[model samples]
Target: MKKRFVSMLCIIAFLFVSICGRIAYIVFSNDFTVSESYNSYVLNLETLYPVIYYYNLEKLTDNRDKYAAVLRPNERTLTDLHNLFPSSQINEITNELKAGYPLVKYVDESKIGNEKYIKTFRMSDYECVQSQLISKASSGLLSYVEPCGKREMRFHIDALGRMLRGDEGEEFEESLSNIKGIRLTLDKKVEEIAYSALSDMQNGCVVIMDVKTSSILTCISKPDKSYLNKAFSQYNVGSVFKIIVAACALENDIEFYYNCSGKTTVGDTEFSCQKNHNHGFENLSDALSNSCNCYFVNLAQKLGSKKLLATADKLGFNDDIKLYDEWSFKTANLPNKEELSSKGELSLFGFGQGKLTVSPLQMCYSLCTIGNMGVKNQVRLVYSSLDENANEDIVKYKASTRVLSEETSKELLNMLRNVVENGTGKSAEDSYHKSSGKTATAQTGRYILGTEILNTWFAGVYPSENPEYAIVVMKENGKSGNEDCAPIYREIVEKLNYL
Candidate 1:
């Protein structure tokens, strides 16, 4: 009887050892080790998607860091590890403990596609598990307890969720403490932008120019800062700088008016219109109106980069002009050596592709060159009022900088007028007001689907027969300038009784 009792005791001991070993194996694994040791813990992963997005978007827009305390893995690094460890034994063992097991803090879209999970979780549960793990790992039982990888895990989860949604706009999750009633002065309706538009705008500002009087009528900035007008913030202008290239063509006296023949090759590079579509031999006027990429590429080589840059600089491409709101604006820097290689690139550069970038205000000023008869006028925000014999009682900021010749401006205007009449900008034409304009559709980003997402734009002046007002509208990632941005401009004009 004693021998039998001892044997039973031994068997029970053996089973206990096996269970404990398996638990250790699952817990000590690299995956859980990294996730468990972080200072911050994610209780519920799915519910925090907005938190993740708001943090990143704010980071990008404000250029400030706030999430340093919460260490979470970025998305890409998590991907490689998951590929190595497909089956998670921890899931089963984790369920054996407590009431229920929470989903892992970090996930990938490729892994979590369309899968719905509960949003809320008790923070106490995460803290409890984390504390117990730390205790067990510290005793030399689980070696992987060091908290190095936890920093980026949360970030990864947020990024994955954002990628799945595909439309994370720029607005941040408003803090309850910061809520204040918005004051509206104007009675006109204010339309809320799509998530994508707001996302693109981020913490940026917008400036709308009326070229006729060198005036900036609309200036708006996000986040409600007291100073630093972002409307003039110079980013990569993309292909909008093409107007400068057109100016170069006219100024050089290169009379290749009817030379805009379909696609042309310069050096080893090929140049074509926006889509390599054939734009039969047309006059210089038609070439400017259509924004032919190939024509400008050939023209850039003839005029050369040095002369082009010089002309652009003279036309307020690199000057500090006050854009109202008590702030100054500067144009983006031009490219150098290594940039002027392939002829196709030069062509794109001429048409505002490649290294060329500018502010919307700068683009307006460049377009204004044509409307003001070749004089690139300095821009102002406030139109001044004078007392008696124009003596300065109240100082208005209205001032114009002459940057071009009258004849040259006239020639450019004639070309642009033809554009609205019969070119890519026909959508911008209003029967009520004769208009001359140019349309731009810039391609940005690497995503295959985003290639179709063009940054549409329309820059022009009204009453083409005798210009009075010049307006410019730029829509980021819109379908087309003719369809998206021009319609907005048209609507605004109609409301103003100007159309």
Candidate 2:
């Protein structure tokens, strides 16, 4: 009987220890009990997209990979997460949140829940913002997304949809999860200007970047009716591609003069200029400024496909630029080098015709390299991101590489400057900011009811004397670059001067 009693005592002891240990784990182990109590907004500077995903952490492993996938830890620290969500005044947006959007507060309790401010919320409340994040976390499709620009901004949301935070540290009040996200490098002034230009258009995209920092200043694609914003869309490059041809020629030392009688025959295929009028004798610089197609056709044949591909590669053509570790850009597609053996094919490739398709961002970055004295700075959208932990992070981008020699880039810039000052891009010249850019009209064999459509482009760098920004303005089914795009470029410069 004593032995049985001892065995019962042992069993009770084991039960007590197991219960205590489990309780201890629940109380002390950080992983067992979720430590993260909050989340902030996330944004992309390069793509102009906002990431508004909020996940319920059921242990870190369950949602970490998925959370990190959308809201990348670009360059933010959890400690400063409060900055991502400021204490701003309660406005119409706050009213909507009170009526039902997820309302979250990061500041001291004293700073929130006052009149004209958002009501404080619980992270676990289903009717609160936390619940919305949980719902989205389980959802296969990201549903909480919103545009940060060109909309009526509620607090941090932007001028009701047509603006964003202008100066940092502007005193605003908000007690909600929606009012949080990183400020993109996009200058509201620039974006407003570009948007104003394309406001009436059905399809077009404009991009302007700081040459030195490679930070996007303005990125707007018109008629943003679809989630597929056309700013990231691809197009046939057209003649503005002559810049690449010219650069390749300069790189390969295949310089020569050509006399254009409006057109040239390549294996029985006639390549004609837009004017179709003889340009007489022309030097390389003059040909580029005049946008003489006959010159580029001959130049491409002389340089051959090999040299053209090399220069295009150096300029990041047919490649993807990984942006802030959030997402990679789509590749700028090009045709196979060997396929250009035909003189007719090489002639088309010479002036950016044929199968050369690229995105506005890629073209902008390539021009940025030329303006940056031939060095290519890694293109980025956001300076940093606020991770789930609220940590602020700045990406450590790769070192700049020399794509064009200093001399070659200088000559190219000079030619481009002359283009604005005297060539087809003369209309883009501005009194506030002298600009030099190239204009091209890319033809899409796709005709609309018998009328052929073209992609009009004006790509150039600003303050010809001191390069600061590289801009590309493109319009689909538009006229030549000078007619449809140059005027818009001038307007962008005028706005930049005011900003």
Candidate 3:
């Protein structure tokens, strides 16, 4: 009996020792504690998206560090769930929790009060970075986040107290560390000014660019729906193409004088000036200032298709102006020489009609080239990116190219100034600043109320003598360039001068 009792005592001692050893291992072993440490670290994890800033460093989108308030379902009761979420969402939340989701988002911060658990776990509101203009220009960099309901609980121990089966925790941490925001060349105040200036128009866009740097300062597009930046969208562009025609004439040393008879016939097609009003015996400068279709038609016949197409190509027509990844000014179309075989086709193409179409952005940049004294600087939207520590990574752009000679550009500038001073773009003249530009009234072939729809445009540079800024204003279904677009251009300029 004594030996049996001793054996029972030994067996009980061994069992106790085994239990203690298991507890100590769980409490102190590195392997066992790793998951605990990871879970604790991940519980405090917050997802951040990139924020977009304006040129002056003003926030264009929401704060990047903002996090979503989340609830750990394993730690909360049904009563807690009922108080936090809508009654309709209770069942869905319960199901998600039961389906191994360790946490769910609590979006209603108003309900989170003095309750210890709620207060301790509450996070910043999950308003992801978003802005209509920023999103469009940023190439989806400032896009919408996923819906709260669909957001996965990033990291937590399961109800059974086991690490959830995934490597997303480490991957998410790495990604978060690499996430960066962008600073754009855009100025919010200027953007707002431009937007307000076009308030009266149903459809149109405005683009202002710095001629020296090719940085877009203000870009506003009307009918601003579904993230569409209409400034980059193509339109007929009307007489704006005459700039290219004039450039061709100047570069080739082609000189001509034509007596305008109000209308000129080419092949079976006849072209007429504005209202068929004759401006007799016009030179290149007079024709451009007067925007004479007859004179340009005669000039186009003289220059032919190859020279026109070459000059247009050099000015970035029929090519995309890439600004950022997957974002660009829509390709401005210029028909090939073969396509302009007919005299009528070439004549129509001469004065910015037919198969020619350009975006407000494209036209603005073309003006910038002329304003920069024939140097075509690369167009840039994003200036730099900000890292987690607020370090800047400046964006690099392609080198500027000489698209026109200084002499030709100077001649064009003089002709454009004449248009503003004494011709079609007279409305664009400001008392404070001298401006130079061309006006265009394009035929869209779309009619409203039996009247043909027109797209009017005024593209030019401000403080004309030493050009600094290039601007383009476009209005759809308008009367004429001077009557519709130039006045708005002047209004924008007047406001900008004050700033």
Tens-digit lDDT track for model 1 on 260-338? 5567777676666766667778666767777777767777777777788778887777778753333353656667646
TM-score of each: 0.53, 0.66, 0.78
Query: Between which residue pairs do clashes occur in model 3?
Result: none
- Alpha-carbon runs more than 4 Å astray in model 3: 1-47, 63-67, 71-133, 136-179, 325-330, 448-450
Range of the 10 consecutive residues with the lowest summed lDDT in candidate 2: 65-74
**lDDT per prediction?**
0.50, 0.67, 0.76
For candidate 2, lDDT tens digit of each residue in 221-302? 6655433445557898887899989998888777689999998998888989986968889988999999999999999988
Model 3 lDDT per residue over 1-499, tens place: 9999999999999999999998776555423333544442244344455666788988776543332344444444445666666889878877776754345365554666534343224342323222335553434434432212212234535334554443223313334334366788987777877877888877788899988888999877666653566677789988988988999999999999999989999988889998899899999999999999999998999999998988877777766776666655455877777889978788989898888888888888888888888998888888987777879989888888898999998999999999999889999998775878999999998898999999999999887887888999988888999999898888888887877
Candidate 3 lDDT score at position 194: 82
TM-score of decoy 2: 0.66
Task: Tell me how far the alpha carbon of residue 285 in candidate 2 is from the true structure, in angstroms, after superposition.
Answer: 0.8
Instruction: Answer with 1 or 2, whichever has the higher lDDT.
Output: 2
